[model samples]
Target: MKGGNMGNMMKQMQKMQKKMMAAQEELHEMSFESSAGGGMVTVVANGKKEITDVQIKEDVVDPDDVEMLQDLILTATNDVIKQIDDKTNETMGQFTQGMNMPGMF
Candidate 1:
């Protein structure tokens, strides 16, 4: 009886692993965007936590205030990184809904 239960648990684990892999692939294809300093700076990042692109408006670029622009870009990039972490948690949390595997989390 115990052997049969172990087999069933193993099958469930395999299925969950497959689902996790698929979810990770989907996440890689997703994108997140963020802006800072009243939209003067914009950043786009993918689920892989990679920066896809960055843009700055002409009006916000000041030769003497380069530090301000740098701050805005940094803020925007951090925002997108937070967003990716949130998304990853939301997507991966679904699989570990019930079972508590020791040392896996």
Candidate 2:
């Protein structure tokens, strides 16, 4: 409650903010990959949960069973997204007591 204590608290908050920004930027620059169907389908995503790429093995592509192929792609995409989300939550949790969760702000 003292003035000096408040000033020090502000400085600490500023430092935490800077570190969080740096972590967010690093996360954004990183890449994540996941596959499904025994490597028949692969999906790549960035830390911001944006899909960067999707690859499918020719052998897995079945014209008659389009639904199966779709399932594989969906599985890969969802897995990669989960990876990004998990990493983000972990990195941000370092500065928070679980109150400032990822994507909340």
Indicate which candidate wins on TM-score: 2
Best by lDDT: 1
List the global CA lDDT of all models. 0.92, 0.91
User: Can you write out model 2's per-residue Cα lDDT over 1-105, one digit (the tens) per residue?
Assistant: 999999999999999999999999999999999999999999998888889898999999889999999999999998998888899878977878656455563
lDDT of 2: 0.91
Candidate 1 per-residue C-alpha lDDT over 1-105 given as tens digits, one digit per residue, 9 for 90 to 100: 699999999998899899999999999999999999999999999999999999999999999999999999999999999999899888988887676865432
TM-score (all chains, Cα) for each model: 0.89, 0.91
Query: What lDDT score goes with residue 9 in model 1?
Result: 97
lDDT score, residue 85, model 1?
89
Displacement of residue 80 (Cα, Å) in model 2 is 0.5
Q: What range of 10 consecutive residues in model 1 has the weakest lDDT sum?
A: 96-105
